[model samples]
Target: MTGDVRGTGDGRERRNTEIVLTAMRELFHEKDLTALDRYWAEPYTQHSPRMASGLAMLRAAVPTLVGFSWEARRTAAQGDLVFTHSLVHGWGPGPVVIVDVFRLEGGRIVEHWDVVQDHVPAAETASGNPMV
Candidate 1:
């Protein structure tokens, strides 16, 4: 919020966005779960309904997801909150479009919430628009 979003200066929100992007790349995309130690903070809070709310629980769940991957399309941040829109694969019947919200403290993720929907190909949708 410290710089003009449309200008050339390095905005604070842009830095926050980079932090989230780096975490996502190291943890979900690269399958390096240990990166969580550096990127995620606990006592963690998860608002995803099905998942538990501690870092240990999150750790246990990650490896269970075989062949899982996240491909981030874009990210935006405001204050301590950053959200990403992405295509997540291997967790659902097909590729799912996901918007993930993260609350970061001291540059580490402390809480999370997400909305997900099953992906429908462009031709199958009434608007014929891309999902991401």
Candidate 2:
């Protein structure tokens, strides 16, 4: 939140970061599918092995995704790419840490990738460190 996107400078980078944040909040937290129209671009490329094909398949699966919410931990942007580190809930029995990278074109997200890991409670880990 303390990055260029929140306030620093370079309007384009700032705008792109803002777009990604709103899109994630609306889609993941609010579970508002309408965000797709406002924030996503067609011919979308999804790199995650969990999903198939392109935009249409993702669109089809959106409604089936439920009970989960996103808590953004960190955000950064360089040019058209925005990287977000977030904590997710209800996707499984416990929380997950997700590092997502999105590519935007003309202000709409056109490509996406993510790494998801089950959050390990501090008591369970040798280092006693929180994943976030």
Candidate 3:
């Protein structure tokens, strides 16, 4: 809202974040990976180790996923940077904490970075520190 993606209101940019997250929720809810392409930019870049860099490859890998559910919380944005702290649930594994950082260019996400940590057993995490 302040740094890159301009415009104001009840924060339509914030709503846009929700839209993408909702799309992802629905896609995973229905186990439809093909829809991912619709939400991603071409040659999308990812900083996650588990996912490949291209949207197409990521889409092709979605069918293998099962019982994945997630919710985005604490979403905050300033300009093109939107940060979300989320809880991810899955059958293949238990719940995990996901920190998702997005970089927007022209209102479309051109890059993404995230870190997934297994649910801490009542212990504080040392991750999520500023990485400069």
Question: Candidates' lDDT values, in order?
Answer: 0.79, 0.80, 0.64
Task: Name the regions of candidate 2 deviating beyond 4 angstroms.
Answer: 1-9
Identify the leading candidate in terms of lDDT.
Answer: 2
Model 3 lDDT per residue over 1-132, tens place: 112233344575675675556556656666666566555576589898777787765666667667666666556666666777777777237778777887766555667899887776443546744211
Q: Per-residue CA lDDT of candidate 1, range 1-132, in tens?
A: 111222123466677677778887787667678888988998889999888898887678777887788877767677878878888888887999988898988889999999999998999999999787
Per-candidate TM-score against the hidden true structure: 0.87, 0.85, 0.71
Off by over 4 Å in 1: 1-10
Give per-residue CA lDDT, model 2, range 1-132, as digits (tens). 222344245787778888998987787667677889999988888898887656677567667767777777778888788888878877667889888899999999999999999998888888988787
**Against the hidden true structure, what lDDT does model 2 obtain?**
0.80
